[model samples]
Every structure is written in structure tokens, then in C-alpha cells.
Target: MPSATLRQPPSIPKWGRPKQTTKKLDWAEIKVIDLSTYDEPNGKQKLAEELRDAVHHTGFFSVTGTGLTQEEIERQYDIGQAYFDLPLEEKGDPKYRCDFAKGNYFGYRAANEKKIMGTAVLDNVESLNIPKFIPSNSHEPFPHFLHPFRPEIESFSRRSLDIASKIFTLFSLILELPETYFSDQHRYDDASEDHLRYMMYHPRPAADDAKVQNTWSRAHTDFGSLTLLWSQDVAGLQLKTPAGEWKYVPPVPNGIICNVGDTLSFWSAGYFKSTIHRVIRPPEDQAHIHRLGLFYFVRPGNEVDIKPVASPLLRRLGLVGEDAEEREPVRGLEYVRERVKDYHDHGDYADKKGKKFKVRNLEIEDEAS
Candidate 1:
């Protein structure tokens, strides 16, 4: 396999962020907590408590196993490395087809194609997204490249799905909901039970300004419920710290990074934040080569409504106004479409000015950095 070391990034000026700032979350301190021991019976309980605080306070954290083994996580990483080692031409066979409503599913996305929110600069990275278990009877045209990858990637998917369920139970418990409330919804076939995965391979930026990779997924929030991520040890992933600084998420041994998405944020009545994050290649001077990550996104079914549930926290946060507004649930497909549009057009509202927008309302365009 060709090593990522063979393809280092070109230099670019770091803008958007200040070289030093007070709003930044300290990666060093977070890592100490992230790698702390939680092996005893009460460890799980303590871990959950700390996790809730981290999610609320920092919007990001390094999570140790809820159930996955280090060996198991490594296996998935190996699978991704093997796939990335494939010839560019070989991987391009299905040829990056995208629908407005499905995000980047079934395609090869170049950098800068998907514009960053509130930034003029494009990113520097390339990626592929593969969905699991395409309903055989469904009419949506599943891409062909996805076929060869299923056998190799299915293991990764299953692992993610298992973890998602486990995490959901914990999240449900934290929400004070019945243990079965979240898991029981998966029984129906038409439930829009999607397990989406992202395999991102960030090549070094080109020396020429015209060909930079989209550094990382721009400053955006996930569309669905929650996300589980296994990021490379390389430093690049940054989240908005409570004080407004961008803190790097350092890798923890066998740890999986997880976060809530917009829908969950809405459902939780703002108790859990759907934090905004972005990816950028480490400075060219850094020793790391390619930065890769495998993301497992747990989302709600297509038809599920999204609104603020009544909670003391919700009322305190002013999420529930005098009039309880029930935001219409966005169809999973429509949410993806707006995302593609925004990726191409750069988040300018497509609809008329002053028009009302609904949940999952995205305006980013699809363009490679």
C-alpha cells in the first residue's frame, strides 16, 4: 500500500482562527481526562457523568470503549487503509454521483467542492461515503462502487451499528427515557434507520492555490441524531469550545469520539448541543502524513418529527417560547439535498429572502476545495 507519507500537503495561510486565543479548548487537559482510568464498576457511571459534562461544556471529547475492543477498532482502520490503497482509477469506477437530498452518499467528493460556512477559503481533502444494507426493494439507485466495498466495509458498518445502539441506550438513560424508547423504534422496516459512514482521506494540499483539498468537513453540524468517529492520531479535528476557541481533539488509545447532531439537539430541547466542527490538515511542517477518519452517524428515521420537548432545562434555556412551536420534521432526503446545494453554492439561501425555513434547512453547496 502506498503510504500517506508519500503525499504531504502544501502550505496555506491559517486564517479564520487567531494564532492564540482565550476561546480555545485546551487539547492537553482534555486528553488527560480522556485517557483517565475508568475500569471499575462505577467507572462506567463516572464515565457517563463526565461524558455528559464534556458534551455540554466542551462539545467534544475522547471516549473509551462502551463495548468495542482496541483490536476491533484497529480492524476497521485497517479496512479503510486497504481501501484507500486501491488505485485512484479503481476507486473512481462508480464515479461520484450525488443527489441533493442524500448528502455525499455514493460519490467521490473533491476538496473545496463543499464550501465552508462563513469562509471564503476552500478545504483540502477528498472523501467517500458508503451506506450500509441498501434496501433491496428500494428504488433509489445505489452506486456500483458501493458493491465491491460492501464486503470489506460491512464489518466496519456492523461495528458502528452495534456501538450506536449501545450509545443510544446510554443517551436514553441520560435523558431519563425508558431503556427501550430509543431501541424499539428500529423494529420497523420503513423506519429510515440509516447507518451512514464516512471514510475521509486527506491528501496534502497542492502547491498551486487552485488545487487544495477540502481540509475537513467545513464548519457544519451533523444532520441526524448522533455520530461516532474514530479519527486518525493526526491533529486536525477542531471543535468550538464553550469560550469560543477551537481546540484540537487529540486521539486517545482505542477511543471513539462522539457528538450529538442537530436533530438530537432539537429533540433534547437544547440540553445537548449540536456543536459545529471543521477539519484542517495539520501544518505542512508537522510530521503526520494523511489524516483519515471513519465516521458512524446515527440519525433519526425520515418521517420522525423534530421539536423541542418540555424540560426544565429547555424552559431555562429559552428553547421553548411562550408558544410551543412544533418544527416540522425534515425528510432525510430533503435535508441531504439542501446540504448538496449549500456545498455547491456556499450556504446562500436558495429560497427567496425573508422566507421561512424549516428544520435541517441547509444551504451549503457541493464543491471540492
Candidate 2:
């Protein structure tokens, strides 16, 4: 395992972020909040302030020195690579395939099982997505040899959840609310379709940069609260700038890239930036090799009421108005199902449309951020 200590700047990023700026972000300037700082007095508060600024303006940042060790991340990656190495038949057994027609995407997503939205091409991505794990009773038993890795994966999930909880606390402070405000709505025992995904983006011959508009994933915003991405050297991930251009998100060593999501932005009364991002063809240098992405999507608990927070900060900024248009409230579990349905062919077993709530119309043309 490589060291998490690749590079260090004690309190801030190596590059400069201009104040009173919101567009044409320099990914190199993105803040990296070292979680270990929380041990110092007022460290959490300081980190929260920096985090709030990053989420509101850039919508993405990184965290170094997270509680999870580098070895754990490497081990999980090794486990995922092993899982992906299985024969197609074994991985595609009915038990593991995502029956999207039923709106369920909790298991294996075969490389050929997906079609990109608004594109005729079948996606070059395959992934294993595991949902919130309950320690008391486990299900969906894997092959005998893989059982040993399950505990490791579960432990990783728990550690990631711990990091999410800490960030939620920082968010609470940033919003001038009680530290437990967001935590209460995200209890682990509560059923939310939050996922820990191990995704692989298969490589291809380099495409002409001028001709490839949507080479891999189409531009989109994530539908959860926060996405915790374990660092990878893969350089295909790009984020849309306020200036309407795509820029690659340069990889940071041992840095878990964090991004604000739709739920968090909505909760903040659209104050937080739910930046649009996409995956494109890799650079010419590495287009011949597969790229692996590891992510943990942190979703709120199922029954948590997701609506605009009555934050004084948002009010001061005039983000929410007395007569402002409103979107339907989202309950966590149902929201996950609805979001996945848009990108997959979930079967009838999933909610089609229901009393739970309609999926909010989040069209790109209508997007604010």
C-alpha cells in the first residue's frame, strides 16, 4: 500500500483560491481538509468554514488523513479487482444482476447490462454496488472464497460512514445549527439505499478530443447527500465549470475527493453547488488501461424529511423566498430508486410512480448550478 502521506500542507491547499470567485475553478486549488486537524481546539470549526466555501463555490474538494488507512483502501481495491475477474457467467447469475426493470440496482451491474441515457451506446462501465450493511444479520452471500473480503468491505463502509458523520457535524456547524442536526437524519440502522460502489471504466483506443463529446458518462449531478471517492490516479473524471467548459479533476494522492450532491444542495436551499460532472475518454497516455473508481454514496435515512433547511445563511443570501417555487420532498429510499431508474432498466418490482413522491424534474436545461 502506498502512503497516505504523499504530500502535505498543514492547514490549507497548495494552490490559491480567490475569494469572491465562483467560476473557472482550478482543481489544483481545491481544498484538502485533513481530518486529523479535528484533534486540535477549534480545528473542526475552521475546517467546516473552509468546507462550506468549497461546497458552495466549487462543489468538490478532497480529504486527506481520513480515519481509514491506506492499507484498507488498497485491500478493498484488491478485493474488487478479484470480484471483477470472475467469469462473466458466475458474475451474471440471476442472484447478482441488477434487475433494474424492478428498480433495484444493489448488486452487480454487468458491463453489457447498461445503456447510457440519451445515447445509443452501451456503457463501458461495470460495477458492484453494495447497499447499507446491517451487522446483526447479513444477506446476499457471495462465493465461499469471497466471504472473507465481505467483512473487510463492511468495515470500510463503517469507516466511511464515520467520516460522513464527521462531515455532517461540520456541515451543522457551518450552518450554525446543532452538531447532530444532519446526523439524526442519517442513522445507520435507518434504511436508505446508500451504496458503496466499486466501478471499473474499461479503457479504449484514444478518441479524437474534437469528436468525442460524450465519450463515457454523460454530464450529471449525483442524487445523494455526499459522495466520498477514494483516490485513484485515473484522470478521466471531469467537472463542468460555471464558465460552461469541462476540466479534468486532477488526482490527489491518498485524497478522498468529496463532492456536494443534489440532496445536500436542495437542503441548503440551493445555496450549495451541486456541480455537474462527467467521465470522458482518458488522456492519450493511459487510454489503453482500465480505470477503477471507488466511491461511497452517503444518503440520508429513508424517512428523513429532505427539504430546504431554514438556514439563516441561506436566507441572508436570498436563496429561498416566501413565494419561491418548491420541489416535491424526497424520502431517502424512494429517491434512490427513482434516480437509478433514470439510468437503468429497473423492472416492475420497483416503484413506477407512487404516493411516496414524484421524482423532481432535474433537467440539465433547468439546472441552476
Candidate 3:
């Protein structure tokens, strides 16, 4: 008998980048770090010094020369757009939905599932979080629509981490520690909450948007160590400045925006700033367009202790005391799971202005105006 032939998966349609908004909005002065020189003798140190002010003050910046081509980045976006285009019943299968009550955020999240700001207007954002491609995560639910592109998705996920690893090295150098200190704690093979996310914000009527303060997403800090967001054109992302001003985060062509998160801030004993950010309805020029986003959220290894690092700078600044090492330990997974639950288990996106979300000794303001 003749051997059977193997079947190949269908290809995903191409996705084009959207045109930028024409509105002259207030833009933030975010510094851009070029990584092309990262392999030079003193490159890492130089980059570290350049990045110091941004991390300490704004907690946001952009990166260029990451060696990822526009074609490769757009391919991932195409895959994500195709997945979101599937029918609700097919894409939002019960088995693949996120288990927020259990603090598991590894699957699909449908849009408009809950009300916003105690109003009748439902949340306008939807997202799908794909965990790291490791054997330990094989048991997690994955969408069947994306199975065909697994190889490409896996490669993209790993490459995103490689870029993040370089940034981590810069952080370590900035703290005057071994270059690999932060990267080692975020090994890709380890079981953690790291995810490559595909998210979208649908447009709502202006009247309904007004009812919810025009917030597509509430103001809050990210829950991980670091976040990498691939730049896209539809406008609405804004970051809160130390001066309490909300300025738009402008998109850089072929560049990735980076930000510090709660865990990194915790590990540095408040030395690293975790700035608050949110998405609002796009300006009238782009309000009808859907805002698609690609992101990689980096979490420390599940077993790594999240206590304040023993950095000389932190010590000299009095951010960490001699007994810092003796403080009760909180593992990476423990804090992340608790945070997911605290942010998502509720039935509505009520006003949480004065609320505090705590995990052990680390706590962050749950909401911002």
C-alpha cells in the first residue's frame, strides 16, 4: 500500500497597518533606545545610561533596530486579526474562555461582556492570551483556529522574548548587577504567566462612550515585570505623567514601546516607576476604525522570589534595607495569579478610584482618574 500524505493548514490573510490619525493631539516626549549597537563592547552600558531616566521617571520608552522586519511583525498581526474575525460562537468557545475567577488568563476574552464604570455601556475590549510554547503549558486551552499557524506563532513568541531579554540586560546593568540577573529570572522555558497577546478595542457610539467617560480601558498599571507593545497607528493610548497629565503615546514606525510593570517595580523596591496608562475612544478622525494591538507581557519565572533585589544603588538610596532579604517571600506566580483575580473576577468595571490591590507586601492603586 502507498504511504498516506500529510495535510497542510490554510494560510491567513494579510493585514495592513491603519493610517495614523490627523488630529494634533498632545504627545508625550518618550525617548527611543536603538538596539542596533547592543552588541558593541560598551553598548549595553551606554544603553543602560540612556534608559535610566525613562525608567525612573516616565516608566515608558520605545526601542528600534530590534532586527525584526516589518513583514514578520505584520504576519503575526494578520494571524491575530484572522482569529478575531471568527464567529463569536466559534472563537469564544466556552472551553477556551479565560477563567478569571480562578485567576487563569490563558485563553480568549470576549468584548462587551461586562458593564463599564457602573454604567450600562459594556466594555469595548476583547483579547486572546497565548501562553509560552512549552510542554508544561500543553494542557492549557488554545484556539483551534490558530493551530495551523503554530510554528510561526511559536517563532514570533520566542523572538519577542529575545528582544525583551536584551532590555532586561540593560536593567541589570543599570542596577549595577550581573548582566544576566534579570534575564535569568525570566527564562523562556520556565512555567510562568508570560503571554503573547492579541487584543482589539471596538468602537462604541459617542453617546454611550460619554456615559463611561469615553474609557475603552480603565487606567491602571500592568501586572507583570515588563510589557512590549508593537506600534500601530490608530491613536487613543495615553500614559499618565508624574505631573498628572495624560499625554498620547505616539506610534513609532517599526518600533516597539516598552514599559515597567508592577513586578519590576516591586523587585526594585519602588526604584523603577510603573506608570498608569489607559485607552480611550480614538479621535473623531479615527473613531470608526477598530484598534488592533499586539503585545508581549513578561513575567518572572514561576518559582523565582520577587523580593527586592540587593542592588547597591537601591541600598544607597535607602529603597531597600539590610533586612530586605529577610522579608517574607512572594513568588512570581503567586502575585500574578492574585492580581488577575483581583482585576477581573468582578462582574462590572466599577469605579475603583480609592481601592488598593495587595499581594503580600506589594500593593498598587487599583484605579486612576
Candidate 4:
């Protein structure tokens, strides 16, 4: 709901020569877990155990039985399509477009402006970032013409957060802490930055698509504790394995894709995987499709300290950092702000310099190099 006058429209027909590349990945299936069992006494623990393994390994999973009916899901999508169908000028109303350059993403970002990868080419994607909305929510309103859709958006975002809240319970249990540990930190009132993002990857010319990999988003990590993505039919979303192979993460019927983020990985002291991921060109069947992506990103409260937790499991696995100084805690909001600022400014991670980070067993030493 963060509104602003926007600039730099995402015009797909305007692009440069395709880059040359000769690499392709053979995608495989990912894990799928049913959440309907969550109500049983042992069900919650079992779910946590199953999730622990998934996060410990690939950090990606598909969840079904969310009780968020397909009708509601499609309703939001249809409404989103309505907004996207507006004249480019209306959608890009500078008063409502998100100014990402200013570190605020509460509005629209025209297609082809976000450079997810540092390549000279811009990404062929447009996104609308909406913050949480309660009657008393602290946010700006959409342009008057778009006001009719606000109720649907607000309701959808709340439902999305409901699921995230349950997932937080599982995470707290997995970390051997009170079930409320994570949920308490993510309450709507004072949470750091949680958003519902609507995205579209404009279909590119074959040459440009190949040059930019059917899409332009490079392999990168999410900025928060968890990200809930409503499944889309396009075939470009891919995950990188520890073996360095890329695999397609296709949508499952009635499923919502969930992925871990940098904050969760840090909190777990690298016990869980915040795997790297990217998007590529779609399959031949989907070549003409312009993909629509729906996502809910969850972060902790601003004052929460995102430090390694004192958990018996992390110690047993020897994943905790040896450099206590390097692992010094940072506020959840500060961590998010710095990481985002670095990427927006330099088109890369801030790890190369003073904003060092530590997550998992990477080639870097105690701190990012």
C-alpha cells in the first residue's frame, strides 16, 4: 500500500541485442507436503520434522490443503489482471508506482526496470508490492480509480499471512523453541517489512529471451524469514542444487510454493538452507505466456535480533559460526535495509565490502569476502 509517483515504465518491446550463451539445465521435481494434517497432535511435530529436512537440504517445498480455495486465489489473479490491463500510464501513476531506487517497494515497478542480475540487460518483469492492510494499517492508498480492488487485496494479503503464521509455528518447533517464538515476532502491528507482491514476466522475443534466460532475474536469495508464492503455470522458476544443477519448480494444483530466506538461514545459524534460485525462459508450450506471479514475503519485527539461535540441533551439526564477532546480531529491519540498498545501488551483494554476511558453509571465511 506504499504509494508514490513512479517513473521508468517497463516497456518490453524496447530491449537490446540478445547475449550469447550455451548452457541449459535439466530440471527435476521438488518436495511437496500436505498441510491438512497440521491439526493432529503428532501432526504438527511430524510436519516440522519433514520441513526441517527440506530446509536443511534444498530450502524449497510445495504445500497443499491451505484451505485457501482456488476460487479465491483466482479471484485475486483476475483482479490483478484487471489492474494490469489498465493503460500503462494509469498502472504506472507516479503517485502509486513504487520507488525502489529510494528503498521503498510499496507500489508498482514497470516491467524491464528491475535488474535482478547485474548483466547490462534489465529484467523483463513488472511487479506491484503491497504491504499488510488492516483497518488501522499504516500505509498509503491506491489511486482513486484503483480503489475498488483494495478490499480484495487486503483480504487476500491477510489470508496469506495466516498461512505464514502457521508456518512460523512449525519453524519455532523445528528450532526447539516455544511455538510462539517466531509468530510473536511477526505480528502485524510492528513487523519489519511484510509484503504481497504481484508480478508479471512479459514474454520476450526468442532472441532476447534466450539472451536473458527467458527472464532476467539472476540467482539470488530472498530478504526475509519466509516467502510464500502462489503457484503459476509458467516454467522458468528454477532452483539450484548443492551439486550446482538447476531444476524447474513447476506449480502443483492447489499448492503454494514456500522457500526459506536469508533471515531464517541466519537465525538458524546456517542449519537451514537459503538456497540460491533464478528464472529462465519458459518451455516451448509456454513460450507465448506472460506469467503472473503472486507472493507473500514475511519478515520479523524491526527490533528482533537476527542472530544465531542457541539450539541443540545446530550445535550437534557443527553449523554454528566459530567467529562470534562476525556473528554479532543485527536488527531485522536494519539487516533488510542494508541488503536491499546494496543490491539496488550496485546490482550485486554487499558482501564484497563492509556489509559482510555469514550464512551456510560458503567459500568465504568467517565473514563474507
Candidate 5:
């Protein structure tokens, strides 16, 4: 059981803007590449090189030619807004509170309500999360959670999963590893935990007041191996560079943004950095400019042990520590829950103290103190 004394802190307030760099992306000059050739044996090698360059330098990139239509994208976005606009009473029946064992999908999770990445402050955006269509093991089918948008959302999810699978395979090839690395690891038929996906709706501020600025999203890194995000056209997406610069990523029609995550960085021995980013709510007059995004988190298989693969590039980059030893790979779901719980309980239990229940490697102090 978690100790009662250190419950997670309330959502972190958006405050004075943090110091940021000036380098901004020239969307016109930002290269968009074709990844479809990855299917061909010869094309895989070229794709691998491209993947390496994108991962190593930009930490984010875009690919075209998967045949994703603008209409499909808009439809999905519309469905998300429709779901969120439902009367609060109408949308509360499938309340997705506290069922972490099966995954955190199926209901409305208020924004800034969950600790960001288990340690950072929560972003001030409520969300109606619906993961990929993975049927649970129960004999009875679970009732559809987001009723009005079920068909559309599910259609979008199926398409996203197919795209994710192809991209994961491309990622494996780029890393010079077996294509089945992640897929084989998440075997649903074997009872292992599988992949999870979600949709997030971030509301605009109520007034055009600048006071609401700091209360919006806070800067932070993503958790999984890879994250594919289909964001809003309005501004507010920014990425921190290796040189400590923050650049905005304005939306590109018919394209989704892909970024490496902490786990992927660790797995690839820091070949990639999980770019840090945050969203600022549009001003009050822009209330109707609410943002809805689809996030797909691709992770390594549940049972696979992840350690930095030894490489000369890693050595040259000084990413591998001299005395670093391999650590057990935490299952994706387990990793997520542990971090979320810790975020809800304490801001820095793992990093500051080394363990969740232990304090500086010592037993937790009595609550009375």
C-alpha cells in the first residue's frame, strides 16, 4: 500500500515562461520524407539510414505516402470533439477511474488531474481516452465507452495500429534488430499485456486573460519508446533541442508528429532524445480552438529485457556509462502504473529517494512526523 503522508501534489500551475532558445522550425524547409519504400528489401537499407538521421538529429520527423487522407483525419478529429461536448452526465456512465490493471482507457480523465509522466506537473487539459481495439479476456464484451464516437474512433484506431505496426518494423530494421522485436514481445494470445493508445482533448482558456498562461501545459518528456501525435492546427507545440533551444512545431495538414521517448533513448543508448514539449491553451477568444490529438505509444514487448545495445556510435557519443550495468526491463503497463502512482503520491520518489516506498533507501518515516 502507498503511504498516506505523501499523496501526489495537485497539478503544477503554469507560471512565468521558462527560459527557452530562439531556434524555430522553418516548416517550409523542414524535410518530409517518404517511408513507404521500407517494404522493399533494398528500400529498407535506405529507410534505415534516413531513420537514423532523423532520430539522431531532429528527434522528430514526418513521413508521407501511407495514404492517410485528410478527410479521415478530420472525421476522427470531429468525433473526438463530439465526444467531449456530450453533457458531462451523458459521458460519465463509463467513468474510467482507477482500473489501471487493464489499462487506463474507456472514460473521461480530467486534465492536470494526472501527474505528468509521474513526476512533472499535470497539464491543464481534460481527456477522453480510448485505446486501440484490443478485446479483453472476459467472456462478456465490454460495453462501448465513448458511445457517440465509437464507430469513428475505432475506425481511426484500427488504421493507426496498422500504420504503427509498419513503422515499428521500420524502426527495428533501422536499429539493425529483428523486425519482430516489439511485436513478438507483446503477444496477446499468450496473455501478455499489449499495446495501448489514447486520444486527448485540450480545452482553450475561458478568457483572453494572460493569467491563464502559466496554468496550461508544462514542459516535459514522453515516457514510452515512440509517440505518434496528430495535433491541432493552432500553435503551441514546441520542442527543446540538444543545445537547449525550444522550437515550435506548428501543425502540418495530413501529417502527424513523431517523437522519440525516454524508453527509446535508453534502449538505443541515447541515440535519440525524447524531445521535451508542452502545449499552451489558446486565449479566451479562441475558446472554440480547443485541440484534440491522437497519441499512439509504441513500446517494446512486455517480457523483453531492454538494455543499450553496444555500439561504436554510443561509445563516441559518451552515452554508455563506464560502470553501468543492465537493469531489468519493466513491463510497459507496470512501468506506466508505477510512474503514475508515484506521480500521484510524490514528485520525486524514484529519482530523489531511489525507490517508491523507501526514503533514501531507508524505511518510510511514520506518518505522524
Candidate 6:
């Protein structure tokens, strides 16, 4: 009898964390919230009080005790690095690429494909956005190499959202609304633009960076409700301070950096900030390293209206008018989809410094300086 054929197990990629930069840099003093206290009595309220100043002032903070193990986080980084290491032909296959024209972001975005700020220097950031694993998104395309890791990816994605929901509860408490107010609008099983992203920024020549004022990614606010960035030590991310100065967002060991986004700010009637942030070339010592990032962006449900909520605090502060509910409504999906198209369906990252992007009554300045 012929010998039976043998099958080989699929290979898993290996990745190690990059060493921290030895050079001292100007780091932003962002507050860190410990989620371990979340389940204790009055824990949510206490955490909300701690987070109040950070959200109201800087719109940026970090979280720890999130129940995500170091090993689990590293596994995600490994998967991201491996996917980015594949040949362009395989990673950038048309079937798996982002459909920016139609406002679909659930796929790969190849690096250096377009010029930045109208300069000859190309954009060096590449990313893969994985949609929620719910059945509705089953039709979305993902790179074949990632198929074997689906179960773990799905688990990570769901857990990230769960952590976000706890944060949402804190936000609601701060706003004097029902604890579930924000979370209800962002159900994981519901259809939304939420994504688990793996992003990489390749270093460019110093001269090329200068052409765009050393901007690796231009200044802009995130479009969703909340953004969770897993801490990494590459040292290029910066946030524009309220006083108009830029400061590096320091890495929090084993913590996740969280930021409020446009929708969240809108929902809170501007009580919660949606700060502008950007990526610049790393400090000279770390400039040659590729900055890898893992993130989960939470968006409101597709059919959910993004109208400012009727908060008691807003009413007391006169931030929301008696006729606030009478204003035209902007659905969550509509705004995000349009924002995605306006920002990405372009040949170049031209400077839109004073332009305004409006949807219904909601509008934001295109501060991509």
C-alpha cells in the first residue's frame, strides 16, 4: 500500500518587542485609570471621577488592570508584524484591499501609495482593519494568512469592546446619565464601523520628513466614539494640547491608551473633548524603527442617531438648548462613512487647513495642517 501523505502544521509568526528609546523626550502627562476596581462597590463612580479631568481637558488617558495579559497582547503584535511582512502581491491583493471610494475600511491599506500634504514624499503608514466577527460582516475580505488566527482575533476583538464598555459606563456616570446610555448605542453585535486595526509606520528619510514638516501622519481627530491604542514604545505619537503645543504621548507599560473621538464629543455636547493628534518622525535615536500599533475603534450602531444626549449636566450648564432634540439628526453610520470617504478617497493628503466637513448639523474643521 502507498504511504499515507503527511500534513504539516501551519506556521505561526514570531515577534519580539522593540527596545525603548534611550533618548529622553517630552512626554505628555496623561492620566492612567485602573480598571481592576470596576466591579467593586462604587468603583465605576470613583473611576469616573478620576477620568473626568482627563476627558474634559486633554481627551487622552491610559488604562491598566484591563485583564488583558502581556502574552495575549504580544500575540497580537506578532500577528500584525507577520501580516505586514508578507509580499505586497499577497498582502495588497485587490480582493483584500480597502474600498475607500465606497467608504469601506475593513481591509488592507498599503503603504507609500499616496503623497502626503501634496509633497513628493509618500505616506508611509500601512494598516489592516478587521471588522467585528459577527455574521453580518462574514462577507468582508481578510488576508488568507490570517485565517488560522481567526478564533484568537475574534476573542481579542470582543474583549477590547468589553473593556471599552466599562469605560463608557464611566463616561455616562460623569455625564449624569444612565450607566448603560453610551454602551447601549455601541452594542458589539450590532452593525457598526468598529474595527480592530493593526497599523505600521515605516521610517522615511529625514529630508523627506522635513518636506511635510516632519509629519508622518497629519493632525486630525479620530472619527469614531472612542479609540483604544495598545501601548508601544516607538515614540512618535503626539497630541495637540489645549494651549496649542504638541507633546509626545508617553507609553504606559502594559496599558492601553484611550482617547475620545468626534462622535463622543458630539454626543456629550462638547463637554467631552475630541482632541487633535498626529504622528511625527520619532526622535533621532528611534527614527529608524518601524512603529507598530494595535487598536480597537468603537463606533455607534449604524442606525443610531448621533444627536447630543439630553444630559442633566448639559442642561444645567446650558450646553444643550431646550430645542436641542428638535435639530436634524445625523445617523452614526452616515457620518463615519462620509468622514472616511472624505479623508481617504483621495490621490494625495492635501492640506485642508480651513475646510469644514459637515453632515446635517454636525460639522468639524479639517485641521490637517
Q: Worst ten-residue run, lDDT, model 3? A: 1-10
Residue 17: error of model 3 in Å? 0.9
Residue 343 lDDT in candidate 4:
55
Candidate 3 residues 153-184, lDDT tens each? 88899999999999999999988889999999
Residue 143 error, candidate 4, Å: 3.8
| Residue pairs in candidate 6 whose N, alpha carbon or C atoms collide under 3 angstroms | none
lDDT scores of the candidates, listed in order: 0.52, 0.68, 0.91, 0.70, 0.52, 0.91
Question: TM-score for every candidate vs. truth?
Answer: 0.70, 0.82, 0.97, 0.83, 0.70, 0.96
Worst window of 10 by summed lDDT in candidate 4: 360-369
- Model 5 worst lDDT run, 10 consecutive residues: 360-369
Ranking of all predicted structures according to lDDT, beginning with the best and ending with the worst: 3, 6, 4, 2, 1, 5
Tens digit of lDDT per residue, candidate 1, span 253-325?
A: 6677777776666667667777767665564443235555677766566555556654444566676665544
The TM-score between candidate 6 and the true structure equals 0.96
**Error in Å for residue 141 of model 1:** 6.7
Give stretches of model 4 more than 4 Å off: 1-25, 114-121, 134-137, 321-327, 346-369
What TM-score quantifies how close candidate 1 is to the native fold? Answer: 0.70
Model 5 per-residue lDDT at 264: 69
Q: Candidate 3 — which residues are off by over 4 angstroms?
A: 1-7
TM-score of 4: 0.83
